[model samples]
Target: MSDLKNDIPDFQTIMLPMLKLLQDGRQWTLNEVMRALTAHFNLTEEHLKIQVPSKQMGLFRNRVGWTRSYLKKAGLIQYPDRGVYQITEEGKQFLANNPPKLRMKQLEQFPKYKEWRQTFNSGNTKEKQATRTEEQTPEEVLASTVEELRNELATELLDKLKENSFQYFEKFVIQLLQRMGYGEFREDSTQHTGQAGDQGIDGIISQDRLGLENVYIQAKRFSNNSVGSPEIRNFIGSLALQGVNKGVFLTTSRFSSSAIQTALDSKQQKIVLIDGKELTELAIEFNLGVQIADTIDIKKIDLDYFEE
Candidate 1:
């Protein structure tokens, strides 16, 4: 049910045991290695059932597969036949050293493995080059890569947002709030009123169809400077004129600490602040200005049928 958790070992952690299993110089099938390692690690049914993000392969099974690939690349093992592998003489010699752990750093020291890494370099990454400390499951690597990409996308989106007109920012605020499941029950529940003399209000959202309660919105498209306490006081004063106690102040820069304190100190009024970074994050999360690019699916063999 879970996908790639910390409880499961990475590909590197399984390297030593995988090599030791073949110490007898006997050929082993992939299924045999999996079964042996399953018991060897004392992995439970729940552990066995745990999958990668794609739900195509078991998390532990994927790690074992990568471990086998790395060992083969390092010349520590060989595939004599389809789905059947055995320890090589070089592997036996390496094992004779009885290294505490067979990590990527150890594998890169081998001439053939180092050459293979240079040719393919799938195993080596900027992360591995920097840390080279611990092995991460492919899922873990993918998650980190995805996070980095999102951060980059958020930065690009924020820059473009600042370039747009204040009217666009006002519309973006109303549309984003609607996309986030606000004012969805009624038509025209969210409105943009950013034109001449809009009384410090950029937009408004009706809580219900009858408009018994409303949330005032003030969107500021600042390129550099932060919103100060004076701006916040004016916005609060604008809300006071409307006899409203709820408001959202959004900006393309940031809020001054004093401005934040002002909002917190507003006794009867509730004001939520959204800065540039948070605004971009919400824009990306609610799919305001982004599109899905690709999806990956990892597959696994039907080990139960093979066991039978």
Candidate 2:
């Protein structure tokens, strides 16, 4: 039983209005955009799940960002702050002159997308248009489009996880590794620490059979606090006793200069460290414990029919 559905046309239809809203001088957050989109289109969160296909707020932000990026690259919009976006003067002129085509050709005007569009439309021909259109189900089209944008968003989130929390932060890392096909890892939830509370390891995973191969994991769920080198040294020490050469240190907080140097200097085992941002990204990539919400379809125009 799956809860996924195809609804891409919904997004193509919404992009303009989204742009216009930004153009109209209304300042809106991602959630506000979500609510507006859902209301104006008579859509629900369920509808958006298919239209955008993610349950995370960050996903929605990422979609808006892609839209903004396309618009901006085309000289249509601009970002004034971390969460704020506004339309540009060129956006007004483009809207006034162009009748608004939701296909890639129109979106290609943006410099950032020129290469992508050129490649996408390279093989397109009138005779083959109909066949290609029919070949793609609405859901499939949306899935592909959203995935491209998701990759960009994942890259952005990767940089932000380093300043967040260890609990949720670590969860994202574990999920990412699992998604990458690394399994048999569990988080540290032990209640007793033999007088040194939770000192054994943040988490552990067996990369192979025979229990001979393993990677030690440490997730620092710091809100803004920085993790220093002494902690990293301790984790390395634990790994040495087990003769494991691979370890991962993840933190919602950034690591100190000394700490990072120490991990590299340890020379005993290789340690991979993931901060908060990277953790969230891995979670998205792995789809660990995450569910798909909805899908959208973007269709190209049949110009040949008009020429005929």
The lDDT per prediction is 0.82, 0.58
Q: Which ranges in model 1 have alpha carbons more than 4 Å from their true place?
A: 1-135, 299-308
- Model 1 error, position 3 (Å): 35
Expressed as tens digits, the lDDT of each residue in 1-308 for candidate 2 is 03324332333456687776766765567667666765765645664554323444433444555565556445566555566667777777767775656534567566534532332232332223435657888776555545555644543454345334545555555556655766544333211112235564655666665555666677766644678888889888878876778988877556778988888887768987765545555677567544565554557899988995
Worst 10 residues of 2 by lDDT: 187-196
Give the candidate number with the greatest lDDT: 1
* Alpha-carbon TM-score of each model against the true structure: 0.56, 0.43
Return the TM-score for candidate 1, rounded to 2 decimals.
Answer: 0.56
Question: Which number leads on TM-score?
Answer: 1
Q: List the residue pairs that clash in candidate 1.
A: none
True-structure lDDT of candidate 1? 0.82
